[model samples]
Target: MSMKNLDRHNRWRNKTVAFRVSPEEDEQLEIFVKLSGLTKQDYITRRLLEKEVVVQGNPRVYKALRDELAAVLDELRRIEAGQGVNGELLDTIHMIATILNGMQEEIAYGN
Candidate 1:
């Protein structure tokens, strides 16, 4: 084979590392790949290299806030059903609104 063809073949023959991922994780990876304008392999490789990546903190806080909001919504529904509004429920709603507003401001300001 020619030198160029030989080099190309060698490059193609290089072994790749494998990592296990849960199905949901794989789906998330695919979504990020699409959103990032990268191929799946390129996205994974860039992430492994830790280059220009933004990593968010654990989503547990967000999940907890979401659960709180859901509970508050249920309470609102009950209130509409004739149980009457409670101060605690109103406070919870305000807290959620504040949290969401803060998040929106942060996103808008690129913080």
Candidate 2:
């Protein structure tokens, strides 16, 4: 063989990992793979390597939450310095706290 052919032969990926899946399972896998924007092989390989495969979620919720929390903390600091607090600031803080508490309880008592 030529040098290029010899190098290519030596670098072949000679491993097989196979499994059987039902149509439903195949459909689910394809959905996730498409969302991940990775080829099926790369997706499966990354999963086997325990890489984090991100999927979309309520990003707007989280972003709003983080912004509210920052605002609340800034207001808190101003209050601690004996500055007058706005009623709306207090309301926002209370609302976010309630939502966070609910999430915590759900996590603690998930089905």
Candidate 3:
């Protein structure tokens, strides 16, 4: 079959997500599914694609981290605006950004 015909036949949703769970777990899932007032597929899709729950963490830790990041960003902007170029400070900021990116990913995935 041609690519055009295949795309038209399957539309955009040609992928499938299949998994198996125990009967007891299935019953529990059904209860929550009914309570959510959404079909099982829609509920599961939303939960997996668009997170409904956030990972738990201490508020103090988040606040401190955010403050530190904001300070770094402010410093970065100031350094960029200044006549002198500070390579070391810029490298430090880049490293911190990379580490924070990893931490964000870990928190998002509940790791």
Q: How large is the C-alpha RMSD of every model relative to the true structure?
A: 12.9, 17.7, 19.1
Of the candidates numbered 2 and 3, which has the greater lDDT value? 2
lDDT of 3 by residue, 1-111 (tens): 445433324655446789999876675566445434455766687688785723233554355446556766776688788756555445545544554576689879988
Error of 1 at 13 (Å): 59
Range of the 10 consecutive residues with the lowest summed lDDT in candidate 1: 4-13
Encode model 1's per-residue lDDT on 16-39: one tens digit a residue: 689899876675565455434444
In candidate 2, stretches whose alpha carbon ends up further than 4 angstroms from where it belongs are 1-57
TM-scores of the candidates are 0.47, 0.45, 0.35
- What is candidate 1's CA lDDT for residue 66? 61
Q: Which residue pairs show backbone clashes in model 1?
A: none
Candidate number achieving the greatest lDDT relative to the actual structure: 2
lDDT (Cα, tens digit) per residue for candidate 2, span 1-111:
344433224754446689999876685566445444456776787798898754332555466567667767887898999999875666566656665676677778882
Model 2 scores a TM of 0.45
Better of 1 and 2 by TM-score: 1
lDDT, residue 19, model 3: 98
List where candidate 3 sits over 4 angstroms from the true fold: 1-11, 53-111
| Model 2: ten consecutive residues of lowest lDDT | 1-10
Residue 62 lDDT (model 3): 53
Number of colliding residue pairs in each model: 0, 0, 0
Instruction: List the candidate numbers ranked by TM-score, top first.
Output: 1, 2, 3
